[model samples]
Target: MPSDTEQRTRAAVPADAVTEPLTDIIDPDNFTPRLLALLSNALVWRESHELRRRFGLGTNDWRIISSLAIRPGASATEVSDFIGLNKAVISKGVVKLVDRGLVLLVDGPRGSRPMYLTPAGAEMHDAMLPISMRGQEIILADLSADDIDRLNALLRRMLEKTRELHVLENGSDVGADD
Candidate 1:
C-alpha cells in the first residue's frame, strides 16, 4: 500500500518520465551504470580542477578533509570504507593533508592512527563547504525537494547493493591489499 504522498508523487510524474526505448545494450545512453559513471567522472574532474586552483588540493584531499570534519579521529581505513575509496588513496590523501598542516594523525589503540582536522583544516572545510553546497544546488535546481530526497534514497540503496556484491565476490576481505 502506498502512502498518500507517494501516491500523489506517482500521479504527478509526467507522462514523458519514461524515456525512449534503448536501442542497443552497448549504447552509453542506454546503460544506467555508464550514465552514472559518466556523471561521477564529470563531477570529479570539474571539482578537482577548481579545488586544485583554489585550495591547492585534489578531490581526494577534500574528501579526506570532509570525512574528518564529520568523523574526527577516524582511521584511514575507516575513512576509506566510509567514503567508498581505496585505502591507499585515503592514505595518500591523509599524508597530503598532514603535510599541509590541515590534518593531525595521532596514535590510536593497537597501532592504528586516528586522524583529525587541524584548526586550519576546519577553516578550509568551512570555506569549501559553500562551494560544494552551491554546486549541489545548481545541479539539483531542477529537482523538487521530494524528488531530491527520493533520488538520494535510491542512490544509497544502490550503494548498499554494490557493497553486498563486493562482499560476496571478495569473501569479506575487501581491500585487503589496499
Candidate 2:
C-alpha cells in the first residue's frame, strides 16, 4: 500500500492538471531559471536604453567591446563562446566594429584570425564601464556587503555546475565553436 504522504499527494493531483494555467504548474516566483533570466534581461534592457541613445550601440556592440576589453586578440569564435552569443551575431558585430575602426582582425599563425580592439574601441569600452558598473551598483544597492559576497560565491558555483552539465549533454559548447 502507498504511504500516507503518497496517498495525500495522489489525492491532491487533479485528473486534468493540464487545464490549469501555467502559473499553477510553476509559479513565476518559484521558477528559478526563468525568473532569474527574465529579471536579469529586464534590468539590462532598462539600463542599456540610455546607453543605446548616447553611444549608437545596441547589445551586440557592447558585448563586443566588453569581450575585447578583457580578452583582446580573441577570434569571433572565442568571443561567441565567451559572451554566450552565436558566432553569426558576433560576426555581424565584428563587421560593424571593424568598419567603424573600433576592432581589427589580425592574421594569426596557422591561418587563424584573431580580433583586437582598436584604440577607439578601447576608449569606447572605458566609456561604457562606468555605466555598466553603475547599473550593477543600482541592482546591488539593497544587498549588504556580505550578501553580495555570498551571492557571488553561490552564482559562481551554480555557473560551474551548469557548464559541467552543458559539456556532458553536448560534449562541447552547444552554441560555440560551430
Query: What TM-score would candidate 1 get against the native?
Result: 0.81
Q: Please, what are the lDDT tens digits per residue for candidate 2 over residues 13-98?
A: 99966643665367768899998898789868965786688787777788889998999898888888887888999989888889
Error of 2 at 120 (Å): 1.1
In model 1, the runs with Cα more than 4 Å from the true position are 1-25, 173-178
The candidate maximizing lDDT is 1
Worst 10-residue stretch by lDDT in candidate 2? 16-25
lDDT of 1 by residue, 62-172 (tens): 889999999999999989877778998998888888999999999999999999999999999998776567668766999999999999999889887876887888766
lDDT of 1: 0.86
lDDT of 2 at 96: 88
